[model samples]
Target chain A: MSPLVIAFLVLALLICGSALSMLWTKNLLHAALAMFLTMLGLAGLYVLAYADVLAVAHLLVYVGGVLILILFGIMLTNQTNQTNQTNQTDTASSKNHLMTRESSRLLPLSIGLSFFLGLFWLFTKGPWMNNLPVTGDSKLKEVGLGLLTEYAFPFELAGVFLLIALIGATFVAKNHD
Target chain B: MTDIPVLYFLWVSAFLFATGLTILLLKKNTIFVLMGIELILNAANLNLVAFSKNDPSMQGLYLSLFVLVVGVCEMAIALAIILQVYRNYRAIDVDQFKSEF
Candidate 1:
């Protein structure tokens, strides 16, 4: 396999493994950490796909913005029990770690695996265009121009949407006392 | 120039989508479920980027850019709503919320 393929495989493993661990772990903090790794691997995958602009944006929005927001959410929403605190120090086990509850794993795993298999079979059977190789290069200029010209209206609308979301979020989160 | 096959990207995206579905179904934490939603969204975005890789019009790429913006907006608002829920109920688990009405 070429180096590019090797890199892609490695990044894919990182992403899938981290996401799996996120599913497996019950500790809320551990899941958050796994999500961080998953996002990192996804950024790498975006790079391999030659969407460098999207890769950077993914890194900034997910790694920098969303993860911090998640951590803050975790910190803010923890329900501390006085009884569990003593037991936690004595045992030093994950039982005391802020738990994020889940339903039975067996059913979900089976369902997910079956879904994945079905999709895999479908993808393999589909006649996707493979003869044409991508004219691989940085898409920064094309993407920028497209946003400014043809997609200018939607682009501006997105900015407005973002601003509205920000104001709405702050209003919603603020103490209503 | 051996561009990676679109099928490979599709396979990975499918795996991601399934995993996200599992998380959505299984996890009780609201934020955890939200993370799963993020995963599914990214999977779709990856598919768009992969398919548009060779297109001269690059429509998929442009769409993915807008998708990213929308995703961030959703995340912010969802977390805010989660914060409000936690304030009212003192819990973040989806099942933990009990309605008076």
Candidate 2:
């Protein structure tokens, strides 16, 4: 086992374990923390795959942006009634107000397991281009050039789309009364 | 350094998709469902990046980049909507949105 493969295994374990913890935990705050770990591991995986630019972008977008958005969402939408009820009955756990409700677990877990197994079998059985020559180089320059030249139109479009979405989100979130 | 087989990435992504799907189904909180959606999106992005790792054209990389942008936009809009929903209903659980009909 080479160093790269070892790194991949460690990152993969980090990702999968945190993902499972996110599923297993009922506390919304715990899930958010788990998601942070998962995103970090995924960035590592992207770097391992030689998509360094994407990895950095992912780290910035997810860790810096999306996670903060999620934390805000959780804080803003907390169930005060549930917290008050728990506060009286369970003083020890009263400080933890981020608990979230979930449906019955058996069915979903079984379905997810079966779906994973099916995909596992399919990917392993399918004929794939395994011997392609590795082009292990940073793609920062080509990506920048392509974004400015060949992909200029779509890149500009994406910028406009992001602006519209942000404006619309603020508009929608504003109090209507 | 020997390149890691693309199959490994595929397997990991498949697991991620399944986990995301399960989270989507099992969780009642709207925010949790959104997190699941993000997981599924990242799973697909990983697949694209892995495929483009050996391709000189790097189309998959470009597409994944766009996917990431679109995903961020979606997340922003969805969370905004969720905030409005919580304000209107005073609850963020999916089951609480039952119609009177």
Candidate 3:
């Protein structure tokens, strides 16, 4: 087995494992941490796939941006029930404030497992172009040029959209006295 | 140099999608549901990136870039809305938002 394939397998394991951990854990903070690992592994997969630009962007956007946003969300939306329980209980159990409510595990797990199996069977059976000469070159230059040139309009639109969303978020989150 | 098979990416993405779906269904917290939605979006992005790995035009790559931006925007807006809902209702659980009617 080649080093590249080994790296891909390792990253895939990391991603799948972390995602499963996120699903299994009820603590919102733990799920956030698991999500961090999942995103990191995903960035590595993007690198392995020769999308280095996207890998870097994914790392920055997900790890640097989205994860922090999620953590803040978890912090801000602390459940009053958990806080009251912690107040009643010992100080050591205060950390359990992040525990979240979830439905019965059986049905969801069975549905997810069946869906995965169905998709796995479909992908393996479907005729996909196989053994094509894979390009190992970086896509940084092409992506930059394409973003500025052929995709220039949409690129600008995305920037404007992001600006609008940020402003709207601030507006919506403000005290509505 | 052995390239990783596209089928491998497909399988991983399928797993991710199913997990995301389950999380969405099982989690009562709005933020947890949002994370599940993020997973689903990333699963689709991975599919696009893997398919575009071979295409000279790199259309899938560009589309995935846009998807990423849109996802960030959605996350921001949804979290903001969630915050407001929590303030109004004092709870972030989906079932807690019962109307007084």
Model 3 alpha-carbon miss at residue A47, Å: 0.5
Off by over 4 Å in 2: A89-93, A130-134
**Position A129, candidate 2: lDDT:** 69
Question: For residues B13-96, could you state the per-residue lDDT of candidate 3 as single tens digits?
Answer: 999999999999899989999999999999999988888989999999999999999999999999999999988888989887
- The model with the greater lDDT, 1 or 3, is 3
Q: What would the per-residue lDDT of candidate 2 be over residues A1-177, giving only the tens digit for each residue?
A: 989889999999999999999999988999999999999999998998888989999999999999999999888887766556755677567656577888999999999999999988888887776435345778889988998999999999999999999999999889899
Ranking by DockQ: 2, 3, 1
**What is the docking quality class of candidate 3?**
medium
DockQ of 3: 0.76
Query: In model 3, where do residues sit more than 4 Å from their true spots?
Result: A82-87, A130-134, B99-101
List the candidate numbers ranked by lDDT, top first: 2, 3, 1
Greater TM-score among 1 and 3 belongs to 3
> Candidate 1's C-alpha lDDT?
0.86
How far in Å is the alpha carbon of B23 misplaced in model 2?
0.2
Per-residue lDDT for A169 in model 2?
A: 90
Worst 10-residue stretch by lDDT in candidate 1 chain A?
A87-96
Tens-place lDDT digits, model 1, residues A101-150? 78888898889899999988887776766444445788799888888999
lDDT of 1 at A158: 94
- Candidate 1, B1-101: lDDT as tens digits: 56666777887899889999899989988999999999999999988988898787888988998899999999999999999998887877888756899
